[model samples]
Target: MALYQQVTGLEPHPKSDGDFTGLNREDGLVIGFQRVDGYPAPRWPDHRSPTASHLLQGQRGPGGSRGRLLELGAGKPDHQPHELARARVLTDPAGHPFCIVRG
Candidate 1:
């Protein structure tokens, strides 16, 4: 939540249920956190690994300027190419894996 505020300069609206918490932006970006047992970080460049999931890359700027990648997960692993064409994976602070691909 602090990082989201730092990056977007906007406060996140909080919502919770049981052990799960979610921070949301009006623009539809949602960040979720939950307590769970035995979560493992996904391996890099290996989408088949446990914890991997697909994410569509959002819009790019004019002249094809690269947009910043926002990953919501556990471990903060470095970005690596996925087995699928035109996709890359990154792990979040919570060890969740995301496969970011161009939309």
Candidate 2:
């Protein structure tokens, strides 16, 4: 049993091209290597919202930008971490890392 197995409860194939979006459908995500430099792209379990989430679900005007990126784990100032004591250390879902790139 590997990490994906432990987390997703499925035996995902190694080296097989997979769409994690199917693992959690309503989340609307896609995983890929973006051709950008200087930033570290996330590996397994890193959340990626599909481009359609912004193009179809969000509002974009003639001069507006494309896509929306959000970290699911965020806290309001009034709310503090009830689980971890650090209070501000944003941990990735499933402990995966992520990076943003600009073109």
Candidate 3:
């Protein structure tokens, strides 16, 4: 929750006592949030943008994974050279798309 607040600058999301849970993947953590409108949304880093990839690559030390790749957006055109291969792709509880790639 602290991480989410820091990253998104949002308040701590309230949780339900229902049988809800979270997933820990090799890429990153997937957090589930249920909305009052009866929908589930997930929070992840904004690694989908091409510019974000470049910044990440720069932060990573030398001799890391290097190569140009395409990042397929939700339905937009694929962004190229997103140096976020080391990042993990995490899906929401409802199978929504999210990613947590960092250098």
Quote the lDDT for 16 in model 1: 68
Instruction: Write down the TM-score of every candidate.
Output: 0.45, 0.21, 0.24
Residue-wise C-alpha lDDT for candidate 3, range 1-103, written one tens digit per residue: 2322233333333343344433233445445443335433432334442221111222133322222111212211233334546554433223343344455
Give the true-structure RMSD of model 2. Answer: 14.6
lDDT tens readout by residue for model 1, 14-58: 666667765776787776656566666556645565753443432
Model 3 residue 68 CA deviation (Å) reads 28
lDDT, model 3: 0.33
Which of the two candidates, 1 or 3, achieves a greater lDDT against the reference?
1
Find the 10 residues in a row with the least total lDDT in model 2. 50-59
What lDDT is reached at residue 84 by model 3? 47
Q: In model 2, where do residues sit more than 4 Å from their true spots?
A: 13-80, 84-103
Q: At residue 6, what lDDT does model 2 achieve? A: 30
> Between which residue pairs do clashes occur in model 3?
27-88
- Estimate the lDDT of model 2: 0.27
- Poorest 10 consecutive residues of model 3 by lDDT? 68-77
Residue 66 alpha-carbon offset, candidate 1, angstroms: 7.4
